[model samples]
Target: MIVDHRIYTCHPGKLAAFVKLYEEAAWPLQQKYLKNCLGWFTTTEGELNTVVHLWGYDSLADRDAKRGAMAADPAWGEYLAKSASMGLLQKQENRICKPAPHYEAYTKAKG
Candidate 1:
């Protein structure tokens, strides 16, 4: 399995707006395409105004296909426009990861 993890840093004082936008606009649309949304979170310490989310995919091809579909959706476009207009985010980072050897078994078991 593959994990697509994202960290989004919001513009100062915009964290609530960013989170609200995703909750109200993006989450429902994303759910239509992404099968396994592991979790969504916001930081309470250390990095303020940061949000993190994780998506699980069967493979890189699966990830690409799902994301591509989402990108093509008009609702996704609307969400993008809303975010862009609000300028809620300062920056974002992405990471693709696989479970470690020892953790692979546990991951599979949980799945």
Candidate 2:
């Protein structure tokens, strides 16, 4: 599986607002188009005003296709517009990862 991790550093004092907007507006849109999305979360400590999200997909192509669909969705467009107004993220970073051998076994057992 492919794991997409996004780290976002928001402007100071905007963490709560960012989380609220994500949960109430952005998350639903993400769920609609990116079915492989595993989870979304924010940092409570260590890195203040940081948001982290993970998406699991069968392959790189699958991830790309899902994101493409999301971009094409009108609801997603509206969600982005609303969420963007919430706050400015100082920096955004994305990483793609593959599970370790142990993780594969762990995931299968969970399933």
Candidate 3:
């Protein structure tokens, strides 16, 4: 499996607006296309206005195909435009990860 971790740093004091827009608009659309969202969170500690999301995919090809489809959707475009107009985001970063061999076993045991 592959995990995609996305971090968004919102403009100072704009995190709430960003989160609201995302929940009301983008989240639904993303749920339709990317079905394996692991978690969505916001930092309350070290990085104050940062939002983080994790998505799991069966493989890189799966992630690409799913994301490409989402990008082509007209509703997704509209959401992007609306979010951009808000000027809430300051920076964005994405990282793709692979689990260590023992990770699955560790999680199962923890569960």
Candidate 4:
């Protein structure tokens, strides 16, 4: 199993706007195409204005296929355009991870 972890740093006070837009537009689209979302989060103390979300996939190939389908959707394109136009985010980071031995069972169940 694999995990796609993403962090988005919003521009100063624009965190609320970014989160709102993402939930209203992008989240639905992602949920529709990528079925194994693990969770979504925001910082409470350190790294303020950053959002984090996790998605589980069966493998790298599965991740790529699901993401490709999402990218091909017109709604996803529109959401990207809207987010870019607002300039709500300052930076974004994504990481692909695999579970450690102890967590493998949990990942297998989730994935």
List runs of model 1 lying over 4 Å from the truth. 108-111
Model 3 vs. true fold: TM: 0.92
- Give the lDDT of residue 43 in candidate 3: 98
Candidate 4 to truth, TM: 0.92
Worst 10 residues of 2 by lDDT: 82-91
Pairs of residues at least 3 apart in sequence or in different chains that clash in candidate 4: none
lDDT of 2 by residue, 1-111 (tens): 989999989899877877877788778878887876777778888988899999988999998998998899887787778767654677899999999999999989999
For residues 10-106, write the lDDT of model 4, one tens digit per residue. Answer: 9999999998999999999898999898999989889999999999999999999999999999999999999999999999999999889878877
TM values, all candidates: 0.93, 0.83, 0.92, 0.92
Global lDDT scores for all candidate models:
0.94, 0.84, 0.95, 0.93
lDDT of 1: 0.94
By TM-score, how accurate is candidate 1?
0.93
Candidate 3: where is the Cα deviation over 4 Å? 104-111
Ranking of all candidate structures by their lDDT, best first: 3, 1, 4, 2
Clashes of each: 0, 0, 0, 0
Question: By how many angstroms RMSD does model 1 differ from the true structure?
Answer: 1.4
Q: Name the top lDDT candidate.
A: 3
Model 3 worst lDDT window (10 residues): 101-110
Per-residue error for 1 in candidate 4, Å, reads 0.8
